[model samples]
Target: MSALPVIDIHTGAAPVLRETVLEFDQVAVQLGGRQILSPTSLKIGRGEFITIIGPSGCGKTTLLRAAAGFVRPEGGAVLRQGRLVGGPSREVAFVFQDYAHALLPWRTVQGNVELALEAAQVPATERAPRAQQVLQTVGLAAHAAKFPAQLSGGMQQRVQIARCLAQQPELMMMDEPFGALDAMTREGLQDELARLVRETGLTVLFVTHDLEEAIYLADRVVALRANPTAERPSLARVIDVNLPRPREQLATKEHPEFLRLRRELYGYLGHGHG
Candidate 1:
């Protein structure tokens, strides 16, 4: 098998060939009379898989939502391809954790995927083929006629992912997408998602509480802290996962670098740091 075109981000050198697709320039968010996310700054390169991991209420979801233009920031700005993102666009796709609720019960897998193209005003003649293509990409072409209720949890999540792919978004914002699945299913979906990202070169911003998951999926992990003050800001630390691509659950976890990263990030969570 040919090697996947994975970016060598752990080299600690700037990737001059890659372009910055999303940028958060001192972005801050406030909710319900309290600051949810303190001014945070980061640049996401095209095709970068960035995972945001922190404590339960560290505004990880808020940061992802802000990037999707669902939450308005109280300060600073979010830029997409050098342009400021004022509102949601088709270029940005969001995947929620609750796959059960995210998919329409009335619609079949293919129909649900069609909704994305329909919303984008894709020609009626082009919807079916596009939907089927994405379904096949996610390994769900055989189950396209099945409804969300009829499919398993992992299959239902694949439908949601296919729908996102149908939209052909430049950036994918996923909020704990695999959190609801069982351990084995979660690992399967992780490998599948990594493969999809490698094939499509999609830039993803995923939020999760699982440290191992973060280390496994991310090129760089951003750890956030809640209730930020000037002394202790929301952006805690950003760690580079230097492990090579095509990571396996058994072999990759046993690697020395992965062990060191796991140990390093373990201290950031549940250690009164966040």
Candidate 2:
């Protein structure tokens, strides 16, 4: 396995804390006889928001799935809170990009959130209040009684997120959760998600194709490459984003560091330069 570089522009910034919540130790994966991910190693600290960005088919989603225990790695291991991830657990909740299909069409928004509790076998008596509280956090309490089809795309996505929050998970794996929404809605949810993560203190491994979104939401960004060999691994770069918190969409994007990081990681996304 090749060594992956961690670029840190913040000399005076805080170092990654010691309380590691997730570790990908030389993890490798193959799908249908093709190596999807080469040996990749990373340690995600507790409450850290790490975003994965790479070109399409660069194993971004595969890596996230491996960490979530949905895809078993062919080599190495994925550990959560110092334990090997055997399979998907209630403690690690996954949010899909396709909100339209993720929710049960027949159920109300409240019922959708409660589905998490139901799947976990959380007591039937406890589901409604717990689901309602989560809905409030995602700003969907007023719409909870409505069905999924009754809400807008963004609202349905919020319902999906609220369901994950209802799970009360320690870790969240979001695979481009806002990729399908319109730009305005996407930006709105990005801020909402950042706040939700802050309030919940949940560790997140989010996958996205948008370079700006990746940098805006991540404490550290992980870049990957496709078609790896022994000399060239799938993992490319891990960069620390030292921008100040309470990031505003307009102001934060204009910040110098944000632009610099965007340019630095821009090549990895395989898009035209700045």
Candidate 3:
């Protein structure tokens, strides 16, 4: 393992020293004779907004899935609150890229949000109000009775977000949640997501291919190296963002600091603008 720098944010809570919420300990993943991830390691503190960015085959999504318990690491470990992640925990929620497959068509927006609570066997009397509150947070409470087909692509994604939120998950793992939407819609949802994270103090691990999106949303951007199985593997890099909090669409993107950070991230990804 390379010498990695650690950053700490004190939450002033006892029983936990420094509050290391999620830790990936030298994780190496292999699938189908291919090295999906190579001895990767990272530590995310509570309430952090971490964005993972990398090239297509660099295992960004795979890492997220592993964190969500969909895949296991061949080496190293995935930990949540100092415990090894054996399976899907109630505290970790996943939002997939494809909303169509993630949500059931037969279930209404509200129903989709309530499915997790239902599986947990939350009392029926409390499900509606909980579901409604989350939907409202995603700006979809009015569309509760509507089905996925009745909403736009953005709205469907909102439902997905609402569904995850209703679980009251302390950790949210989102894999390119807005990649399928139009630019305007993507930006709109991005703002909404930032708001939700701030309001709920959700610890987010978001994966995206878009550098601008990464810079705009993340407190730190972790860039993955090239495929480890490749003839020559690149180096993994992490860029710390010092931008001030409470990011908005226009103000954040247009800020001089945002551009500088974006440029640095692109450079770390081996991209340079002429």
Tell me, by lDDT, which candidate is best. Answer: 1
Cα lDDT of model 2 by residue, 79-127, tens digit = 8878899998889989999999999999999999999999999999999
Candidate 3 stretches with Cα past 4 Å from truth are: 1-18, 229-235, 271-274
Overall local distance difference test of candidate 2: 0.88
lDDT of each: 0.89, 0.88, 0.83
Which candidate tops TM-score? Answer: 1
lDDT of 3 by residue, 1-274 (tens): 1222334323323333336788898877788967888787788877788998888877888898888888998888998888899888889999988999999999999999999889778999999999998888888888999999999999999999988888889899999999999999999998899888988889999988888899888878888876575444322777777666677778888999899988777776776211
- For model 1, residues 62-172, the per-residue Cα lDDT tens digits are 898899998899999998898888999999999999999999999999999999999999999999999999999999999989889999999999999999999999999
**Which ranking of candidates, highest TM-score first?**
1, 2, 3
Q: For model 3, what is the alpha-carbon lDDT of residue 147?
A: 93
TM-score of 2: 0.93
Which stretch of 10 consecutive residues in model 1 shows the poorest summed lDDT? Answer: 1-10
| TM-score of each model, paired residue for residue | 0.93, 0.93, 0.90
lDDT of 3: 0.83
Candidate with better TM-score, 1 vs 2: 1
